[model samples]
Target: MTRIFPRPLTAAFAATAALSLAACAYNETLGRNQFLIVDDAALTQQSDAAWAEALRTQPTSRDAAANERVRRVGGRIVQAAGLTNRSWDYAVFVSNSPNAFVLPSGKIGVTTGLLGLVRNDDQLAAVLGHEVGHVVARHAAERYSTTALSSVAISGVQSVAGDYAKAAGAIGGLGAQLGVLLPFSRNHELEADRLGVDYMQRAGYRPSESIALWRIMAGQRQGSTPEFASTHPSDASRIAALEQYIASQGWS
Candidate 1:
């Protein structure tokens, strides 16, 4: 007996093969030519929408003094970093996660947990500056571009594979590709640390406070590790890098 697959299937497979090759070629060329793909506008739009959704869903603190402190520090860093032209906003959330993040649109969020860990305003500035560094350097968009490329590649592979299950499995294999993206993240973190220190110094905050701040953070994770560990550089590694950057900048 003989079996025949539909012509549509064959055409789809051909299309998939072409797309996969195109994606590979684009990635190779773009990777060599540029480090980032998406522009600032698109990043800002996506980030703004996400930030708005997060703020809407999460209950935030209304403490006048606490909010003032966040705004004060955030404002200083923004000005020092020459981000005055950017649409920036800062908020302190009432969470105990010891975390902070800055959106591509300059929306900044710092958890109450992080505030408790910080000893002074300067330390807070250091943290905020680092988060802002991620934004200024457009790391998130870079990640997004890579992710889009991967999605396209996977779609192409699925088209050729013809078996949805096999396609899903192939897509699942993207963890390694994602892991390869980490070096870029690490580089961004180091750059942020350097930029944060510079911003703090210019804002009249002692850059040395960053060292103390990270030390305190490292000490705080005595028993359990936080979820951010997966995405963020390890505490020891980050602190060491920050120290080296500080020393190089002659911050002492």
Candidate 2:
């Protein structure tokens, strides 16, 4: 009879022990207990790299006046968002995708396609406020941290199994699981919407413009989904959440 070995069991236990210690170490460094594992500096570096690559491939707006308008509104929103510690760089992309994003390192991009959707400075401020809220709340960092934790968990599993093929298959399965996390992404969108209204109001822009902006977006989405839907709240859901937030806060 073949002798049975405890290598896999021992390795599994060891991996679990290491992960526990790592969690403790991460908490110490963050100065608080956090459910997500993350390295802020590493996430910032990754964000910067991704942003740089995007800028290189994407076309930027050449219309000087339009660019200026976006910058002006974006500047006010950034300031009002109180993210002075972050190095903010705002740009107008020449895409017709009607989308916008705020990167982890405070890089803001607004597509020219969204210009027509914004009726005035206040409406534009509403959009900018929403984008800036993502940066302020460190949503990107949270997402990255979740991804890192998953990678760590996979690594631990692989160490115990000692089967590279199995590990690869497991990773593919996990990737699919992560892909289904779109609702979590949507939750981030709602949080940003609530914070955006408050930021716009504090900046002296009528928070009501946010509702109007969403109306315009909803109208545009009647034919098909907006590009913003990939990373934003649905129009009706966003408008309702914003209204609820405004009502709760008693902000006029």
Give the winner by TM-score. 1
Computed on alpha carbons, the lDDT of every model, listed in order, comes to 0.75, 0.73
Q: What TM value does model 2 have?
A: 0.75
Pairing residues by index, what is the TM-score of model 1?
0.78
Give TM-scores for every candidate, taking all chains together and pairing residue i with residue i: 0.78, 0.75
lDDT of 1 at 66: 80
lDDT tens digits, residues 1-252, model 2?
986546764565566556656754333322344344555566777778888988899988788898888888887787787777767787888877678888777788889988866889898888889898877666676666555555555555565565574966577455634453455577778877877887898888988888888898888764655534355566777888888888887876
Candidate 1 lDDT, tens digit per residue, 145-176?
66665555455455545557585645544553
> How many steric clashes does model 2 contain?
0
Q: Cα deviation in Å at residue 66, candidate 1?
A: 1.1
